[model samples]
Target: MRTGGKRTASVFLLLTVLLLLLFYCNLALGTRFFSPAKLFSLLSQGRGNDPAVSILFKIRLPRALMALFLGGALAVSGFLLQTYFANPIAGPFVLGVSSGARLAVALCMMLFMAQNRALSSFALVFAAFLGSLVSLGILLAVSQRVRQMAGLLVAGIMIGYICSAATDFLLSFAADSEIVSLHSWSQGSFSGMSLAQVRTAAVLIGISAFALLFLAKPLAAVQLGESYAESLGVNVRRMRSALIILASLLAATVTAFAGPVSFVGVASPFLIQSLLKSNKPLLVLPASFLGGAVFCLASDLIARTAFQPTELALSTVTSFFGAPIVLWLLVKRRGK
Candidate 1:
């Protein structure tokens, strides 16, 4: 319709292509590489009892799907936080939501191991959600005290550090035998995703994402400020509460499965907004979700392939790229 709209449309098309390309690369390239032709052949043959087929079906496909859903959910969650706080830097990791979730999951895992009990998926999500809410509560309280956005951000980072320290403290008391497994989860990963886990993430993230979409209009109004949003008939208090719950739920889901993959939440929304050149929630939300899927899929690919036999943690790669973007944003904001 307009020049900006055409630009946004073109950007969306480019992101879609990039997402597909990254998805294929993640499935095809790993410790053992599979050519695109081979990947197609394996999949086309009804996935018979072949080892490569098993790897494709059981490992790569599930892992890729997990990245798409959880990564998108994390991004959408971050956008929700950013909208709620009117801060570009606000995200699950930056605000300590992921750290809190990680801490809770670690505690649950340690407790289960100590008692020789297995932790269920539902229990893991519940623990993570509880911890995320705890962190969000502290964040909101701190936000009230801080007049400047930077002050709030610093407080959020401090909260994250405290949660991380607590997690490390708990790990120190873990049994030596259990340390390896717990350590892996704490580092954040997309590995070992089963079909069941994928299905579960899909349902949780799908619902959360759609719910967010439903709130897009109100959220956009909220972004304009509480007074403006109220003038527009948006219930500011209820909207904020919903944002917190939905954002926390999505963050908890990611933390529960992948142990808090970093920076996707922060980076994706900003990147999409830049490309879209618009802040309209209807456009930004969907683009951010796709961009997030691409970001994590690419990061997961690097995590798996960069070190070859020993995989780098998913958060490691994300933070490497994400932290700089954040610094640049802070600098740009200051420039203004």
Candidate 2:
């Protein structure tokens, strides 16, 4: 067991270094590869009349940073949801939170577009948050009646389909130009993120991440069951409330910026737990966050370069990878 623990710690260290390298790779290697040294020089100095430098700053950096923050947020949200529900498969995407957020954001976008008003970034996030809460409310109500985990999951999926249908119906009535924009976003591409949006996300996600970490102990206690958690002096109700709000905010932020990414939330925690061979919350949370960052960064890289001129949506690449992991998990659980 000690040897296995050492190996997992080593893996975490390796992943951290790999994540840093991926950051640079995402910045420098694209359709046109910039030398690492050149990137350093560009950053060290300023973008003094160089169009490439502008592309580097105005495009790649923000996207990579978005992938980092939103990806980590999505995974942590999944961890919280899974912990709360005591189900391995429970997550923002699987529970319809992402789709709910997407529907809300889509409606907001259509309204803004119809009025010829530009939608602010924070407005999109707020809309998504409200949508996430609505979906969460429905899921919680369903949970009270659903006796089995399968029934709960089925209900969640139904909610997702309903939201997706609503989003599609709304888009059908939107202007052609606006539809084009909304369609790309709804499909989940991490392109076109700006520095200002990144700053906002960083600040918000940062505070939330810290709050989550602070609750790690309570979260772990809750995993055993509400009665057990309360016996240990953890306020089960408040803990659950925090979990729902934090998970919703995290999910909403991702949907707001990157659209509805599939499966990362459901997959990252499993992958991280497998690597660590432990379910301790303190260890799992950070490892899960890093795993998520790596997954999204790699997925984003493939999305941009895999099809050359035709960049795929971020979710396409993630779904290609994440879906299989989810399937494998289901099969493994069934076998167990």
Candidate 3:
């Protein structure tokens, strides 16, 4: 057992190193050519008449930072939801939270654009929060009477469909320009992230991530079964509520900043679990965050550079990788 534990720790450390390297590489490579040598020199020299330095500092940094926080937030949310629901396939989107966020964002964008009013970033964030909470409330109500995980999942999907229908109805009545904006927002992109937005996301995601870390032990206990957790002196109800709130906040913030970049919340935790060969939240949670950051950064790189001069949607890149993995996991579990 000790040997196995040591191996797991080593693998996690190696992956963490690789993730950090990829992050720096993302910083180095972009549309503009900033050679590694020049980038290093510019950083060391403080302020210089270097256009590359300015671009890196102003443009690339924010986008890369946004990817990091958004990825971490999605992965952490995935981990919490999976553990709480005891379903490997469970995710933030599974509970209709992302759909709720989409609805709120759609309504806000349509109303603001139609009124010719400038929409503040805060308004967008608040809209996402409100939408996610509405879905969460419905899910919680259903869960109270439905003891089966499968039943809860169905409730979530039904809620998602309802929200989607409502969003489509609103879009039909919206102005052409508003519809265009909504379509773009739904596709999900990390581009055009300002430093201020990145900073805000980072702070919110950071705090939420820390909260998850602190609850890791309790979460693992709850995974054994709520009654078992209670026997161990764990407040199952409080922990469950905290997990929902944390996951909702994490998902809402990421959707608000990065748009509804799907599958990260469904895929990242599973990837980390496979890598570590363990479901202990203490191990899975942090590893999922790092894995998520790596996955998103790599996906963004492909989205930007895959088809020269033509950027792809972030969702498209992620889905190409995420869909196959999810199918494989489903088949493998079914065969067992």
**TM-score list, all predictions:** 0.96, 0.97, 0.91
Worst 10 residues of 3 by lDDT: 39-48
lDDT (Cα) of model 1: 0.90
**Per-candidate alpha-carbon RMSD to the true structure:** 1.4, 1.2, 2.3
The prediction achieving the highest TM-score against the true structure is 2
Which pairs clash in model 1? Answer: none
Candidate 2 lDDT over 220-300, as tens digits, reads: 888777889899999888888999999999999999999999999999999888888888888888888898989999899
Q: How close is candidate 3 to the true structure, as a TM-score?
A: 0.91
RMSD of 2: 1.2
Every candidate's lDDT: 0.90, 0.91, 0.83
Candidate 2, superposed: residue stretches over 4 Å from native: 1-5
C-alpha-based local distance difference test score of model 2: 0.91
Give the candidate order by descending TM-score.
2, 1, 3
lDDT of 1 by residue, 143-260 (tens): 7788788888889889999999999999999999889988888899989889888988888888887787679999888777889989999999999999999999999999999998
lDDT sort, best first: 2, 1, 3
